[model samples]
Target: MRSFYNSETGAVSIYLIIILVPIFFLQAVLIDFARVKAAEREADTAARAAVRSVLSAFDTELQKYGLFGLTGEPESSESLFSMIYKENLSGSSSGGFYKLLDTKPEEGHASLTSLYTLANHTVFKEQILEHMKYTAPIEFVLEITDKLQKPGAVKTLANGSAYAKDAEKIEKLLVKREELLDRAWMETVKLKEELNGRHHTYRARITELNRLSELIGLNTADGVRSQIKTLEEQIRSLSDSISSLNGSLAAAAAAGPEAAAAIQGMMDNMRSLQDQLTELQRRLSDLKTLLDNIVKYTGLLAATKLEIVSDDEKVQNLQKSVQELLGEAKKANDELNTELKRVSSAAGNELKVFEAFKSLKILSEDDFRTYQTGIASSAAMFSGFRSGIGSINLFTNANAQKIHAANDAYQAQMDEIYQKQLVIETERNKRNETIRKEKEKQRSKIQAALDRARQAMGDCGTDQTAGSVSAFYETLEGKDGLYGKYMTLNESPSNAGGSPVYDLEGKPDTEIQHAMSLLERLGQTGESIRNELFVNEYALSLFNYRTYGREVDGSGQPKPLHAMSEPSGHKLPGQEVEYLLYGFNSCAKNRSSAYGEMFAFRFAVRMVEELMDPKNELLQAGSPLLVLLVSAAEAAVKALADMDSLTDGKAVPISSKLTNPLFTFTYKDYLRIFLLLHSSDTNLLARLQSLIELNTERTLDHAVTYIQGSAESSVSLWFLPGVMKLMNGTGISSCEVRENRCRFISRADLAY
Candidate 1:
């Protein structure tokens, strides 16, 4: 008790201790307040981010609504704002205080209820926000509002905006449609090509079947079946031809005037042949009925035939090769089917993208309807490749089957013939022994007959005009001496009595004799030798890169029509069409679809100029070009006007827009005629006609050879006075044919 009373020094320490407690508590209160403030700031930041994200969802919808003076976005199946919130902030971020709030919700709720229970103390709750864990219960409302606009102005804006969107979509659709249509047209062309090829195969098959039928004797079982197959093939061929003709008619109609005329002519021809077609159809129907009846009795035919087979090595080899081919073709068919499936899947995806655009409702419903239709048609055409390939497979299989059946039938026929001979073999052998002896006695006389044969005939029968195969091919390809219409024009009725006396063959002959004749015939016509070239002026400049292909290097060729500074050099030989050129007369050229009119135009102008030149020296030399156009004033112009003629179309009268200062020229009338010819559409009828003409078909204008110092080059430059269609297996770039048997040639090789 005395020591405790001595610690008066401890009293001041107690007072200091008591003062430190309040100071410590005050420091803790400041730290906790800082925590609450920081949490609130973090929560505010997250709220802003979440609200901003949700606001973005309204842009497109807002655009639509705002433009129309609407208060809000259009109703959608899903809540855009909720979607944005989940995507942007809360659900995924799970904003716990470390996230959005300071304490766990259950813990914070218990503490807040006991310590700060009243809504009146929500401010007190923020003071303790650090103790909270999540903001889920304390919802953050994010309003995405837009400024309102005048109703009338919004309507106008919406109309403008929707129209702009629709217009853009329509434009894109139109471009796509155009591309698809082009592809469709190309596919249509390919389809036609396939059909034509099929027609040829069908023809060959029919012929082969007929030959086999004849060999087996037409009255027999195999023969009758072969005949039925041939008739069916004929029916198929007729049907295919009719389909091809329909395409041909459509193409010709769109080709231009010349083809239009050809279309009319074809229509007229069809009218003439309608009855024949009806009869053919009737015959086909009857044949089908007959075929069905024959097929129904097939079990009876199989019963009469034994298992005998032909021992012919040729047939056996062909059958074996065909079987191997069928095996390979099957593999290829499988691969093609797989590729086609992939193509189908790709097409489906493309349709989905198109449908996606449609769902936006930004395109004019009616405006793009045509595009869909066109796309469907184009898709159909492209898909036709599947059918084309399938048909080829079918044909190949049919051919293999035919070969197998024919072999079996051949064996049966041989066996039947041999069976009869077997019954009398012993008697024939005894008779042959006596006959052999008699023949041996007369063997010396046989030498005299052999000697006479050797004396009369040379070795190997060498006097044939041409190979049988070659002759047959030539006949089938329509090359048996028909001339092109260009060379067949009679101009004058008086000369219609006979053909021209030109001694020319189809080959490129450059013998000294032919050169002399051509040189004399085409000798410098009047003023051509006196022609001068203005190499330094614009005269030659105009033709520098021009496609005249005419050698103007001091040659006696026609000067390019564009060398306008020198007006007196003859025009493209056409009287008024002096500037129209051969190479430049492209159907692909600006404002033109064909060059045949250009050819006829050249012919007409040259003819008129020749007659009216007042300076043409060729008139005295009995000019052939002029003679060919002797009826130019009447028949030539009439031919151009006639829809049935294979040249060009009628000329139009030159109007005001096309009036020229040069119209006052002496040949202005002919110029007007030329203008009319150029303006008029000349369809591909003439070119197609020329292209399909046979090699032996005499050309209208130039002959096969031209003078190059007597060195002839085989070229088919079809742009001159005598261009003709190039024929198969002969052109410079033509592919070689590889058939073992004689095959008909086609003129589709006329690319040049």
Candidate 2:
């Protein structure tokens, strides 16, 4: 055998045994390494699956609270791993490699020994030891012990070591990722705080707007009241002046011929003044009409102004409130930004951690390549988060600009309204000044006419004309005057006594002179009567007197009275028939013929009655004529009184009604038709009110529908479904896969 062993063939056989046997053993060791690698891949795959499930659950919870994707940070790999461990390994059936170790094992013999003891020996211990010598100082013992325990123990142990290293690297990266997630959560909280503050400010602004609306209506009401009061005072002053004038005119008629002439001249002057006063009054009435129109327009403007001003104030208040709220919101945004920066920093650190894992020599190139995919995915997710924050800021800026534009438009409209109001005020002042000047001029002319009439009456002897004047004056004083006498002459004496006349023209000469003196005194009483007549006539003309019962001739001129006729037969006892007849005829034939006829009839009838004997038929005949004149005068006074009462009744109620802008329009219509023969604008106020009511109702309905719909619609509805789809499809790939080896193993094992 030695010779054979020593031979070249024998030596070749020994060499072949040594080389082939070792080669076969090496192949077995390699197979074991492959099994170990597969186990590690399986563990990593399981861990990753578990971790991903937990992350998905967390994201769902965040979305439920409207906080999903608020922060720009990717899910941490360490957090993912920890969540998987807690969920899948913390309970029953928890006796895996993870359960065997009380804590993560350090790189030492104790960790190797523990794993080796648990694995036992089922593989070629000597070969495992040889392979292990190249890896760790204690790897020889660990590999041999692990191979002896079970048939698959050596492979499982080898694979578990690789998976454990992969998991450790993933865990380190996950730790940094967890820091980023924490920062993102803080940022989301800050942004939410800002939004809440802004909402509060908006609410306060709405309340202020409501208050401003009420103030506008109140101010308009006050302005209208002041104008109505000024009109009432002017009307009252005119009425009092007219009353005084009537008293003076009665006394003047009792004076003699010279006094009557003086009174006639004064009356003419008074008539002229009345014409001027009437013109002024007409102008005033026109001013009142214009004011009425202004009031109507102002009231309408006030209503709209109230609404607009209130809305504007509210918007401004809301802006201020919102600004304050935005300040809080900005703080929150700033905090969010800070948190984002922190998250970015943490995420970057995590990326560094992932990079550190990538640099590990223990991982195969293929495993490292899978790890790179996960790190890239995480980085991409952080970038997407930053993009989302930018979008929110853009939307906020756009809303602020829109609010500012609305405010500018409202201001421009207000300026235009103010300019129009100034023009109206200027016109009103000029009109008032002209009316005041005309009134002063009319007062001066009337006073001079009254003074001349009083002096002329003093020239006539009081006693000489007393009897005729007193008798005539007595008949005039009776209620029914001449009409009562005419009725008395037709009736029996008993009936005549009860009629409006009782024995006309039977007074003494002294009494007649006293009556004439009284009439003459009216001319000297001053221009108050003339001024009143002027004002009343002017007012009538201004408001269109012809429309209110003034008789218009064929020529379209106002003819207040038509014909005047004189009484021709009698004269006073001491007076010439020629003088009396001529004086009466001349007065009757005057331009103001009706007024002249009235005075001449009274004077002639008085003279004829005084000259006749009380028992004669001619004297009795004259008595009836005197009675008729007195009755006519009484009827005239009664008609005038009735007119005064009518004026008062209509004026009081109408003035009160004018206080309300809406009611003023209605009153104006009624007055124009009843007193001026014209109608006012129709039902304008009611139409406006109806329109406002209808608009309000429609707005309320629309608001209700909008509110209800808003509640039903989800906030997420505003987010396009396409956006979610894009994020789901592309964003997931950007997230880290911390346990690639474990994931590979599980996929491999499950492969059919």
Overall lDDT per candidate, in order of appearance: 0.29, 0.30
Q: lDDT at 269 for candidate 1?
A: 60
Stretches of candidate 2 above 4 Å error? 1-401, 424-428, 443-460, 465-486, 490-752
**In model 1, where do residues sit more than 4 Å from their true spots?**
1-151, 216-752
lDDT of 2 by residue, 118-160 (tens): 0111111222233323432233222322232333322222222
Supply candidate 1's per-residue lDDT for 59. 25
Tell how far residue 462 is off in model 1, in angstroms: 98
Q: Judged by TM-score, which candidate is best?
A: 2
Cand. 2 TM to true fold: 0.16
- lDDT value, candidate 2, whole model: 0.30
How many clashes show up in model 1?
Answer: 20
